[model samples]
Target: MYKKLAIMALCCLCFTDCSQASRSVSCQVITITDGDSLTCLLKNKKPLHVRLADIDAPEKNQPFGNKAKQFLAKLVYQKSVQLRILGNDPYQRTLAVVYNAQHENININMVKSGMAWAYTRYNRDPMYLNAQKQAMKARLGLWQDAHPIPPEQWRRKKRK
Candidate 1:
């Protein structure tokens, strides 16, 4: 258990580019703003806006974007989840690795199912990398697109 926590901590430090430190919080998901972000209500009833770490989902306006959002909603909306908060993003949303009650990592699920791409910029975990390769090989979810555009790239083009 000690080793596991240590590895997870290392991964968090490598995966998050944030302005704050890491912590843990338990909450109930109240809303899914997009495939990669959600609002969770803390036990005290305060809302924590969070962006999933290690993966980037499609932009809401991009192809497969709504599908990704629906997929995330189906898995976590209203569910009780635990978040390993790494830090705050520029938007003030907490960046975290979210796990379901069953201890399933929801961030990895998105990549495994191809609803999201491993956010390689900060993600260096082999599990996430492997999942992405398998998803692409099996052509799951958004991988079904003959030429799927990554969310970051899609966003960049949109701003042009």
Candidate 2:
């Protein structure tokens, strides 16, 4: 009886993680909306608007914005992507951390490459913060700007 109970518990634990991992959506990125967003076509012919989670890229008008977008495009456009859905943002876009076929985390790479800032308020991962710090130290991409303004602040200023 004890052996049977142990086996059941092990199965439950395995399925819990497996189910969450299996929830990932397989899709093709048809368009690069910006540095941190994309338009994808799911296998079921459904369209999903995805916003990269835990990172914020520059606004189109902001310095290095186009570079950020271009970088993202080079990484995923016209390629199959795996999206692990976290949730939706206020804008109703599905928030996800995208992965390439090689299993690389695209969102974190954006930070590591200095194309985007780790959205500190929403990102609790020390790896993300560490990547940002390293990028800043190396003066990559937007970090090259002596005073690069974050997208959040840039958007607020634009609103005003």
Candidate 3:
């Protein structure tokens, strides 16, 4: 009886850990504000502001900014996505790598398709970095300009 009890306890522990590791959080894409920012309706029916992890899109007034917005809209607007919430940013937006219902990685795809730049400051994903480099080589989207200002630099210049 003791051996059976021990086996049961072990099984329970393994089940608990597996469940925690593979848990899926559901969220609806309420709005796609731009390449980086969006509003999501979480499983609890609460609206959440989500920032795409590992990428930065141009601001509204910046070059290719409108194209970024349109690209994101085509990818996520009014669709349901899954967010593996890494944490929250300083701005209170949930910092997450979102995936579509089809299990496509939206953040990496944006970089690979030349719609956004890989934000290396907070992300160390080598695949994303390579994709961005490839996009630059191909002169995709924002890279079409001989010297396109990075979104971060553009924001700094505007502040001055």
Please write out the lDDT profile of model 1 over residues 1-160, one tens digit for every residue.
9997787676555544433556889999999999999999999999999999889999988888999999999999999999999876667688999999999999999999999999997778999999999999999999999999988889889899
lDDT of 2 by residue, 1-160 (tens): 9997786576454322222332588899998988999999998988899899889999888998899999999999989999997666667677788999999999999999999999997778999999999999999999999999999999999999
Q: Model 3 clash pairs?
A: none
How would you order the candidates by lDDT, starting with the best?
Answer: 1, 2, 3
lDDT score, residue 93, model 3? 73
Any runs in candidate 1 off by more than 4 Å, and if so which? 1-20
Candidate number with the higher lDDT (1 or 2):
1
lDDT of each: 0.90, 0.88, 0.82
- Candidate 2 residue pairs in backbone clash: none
Worst 10 residues of 3 by lDDT: 14-23
Model 2: CA > 4 A from native: 1-22
Please write out the lDDT profile of model 3 over residues 1-160, one tens digit for every residue.
Answer: 9997786576454322222233457788988888789998887899988888889988888999989889988999999999876656667677778899899999988887788889887678899999999999999988888898888899999999
Candidate 2 at 159: error in angstroms?
A: 0.9
Q: What is every candidate's alpha-carbon RMSD to the true fold?
A: 5.0, 6.8, 8.3
- Local error of candidate 1 at residue 36 (angstroms): 0.5
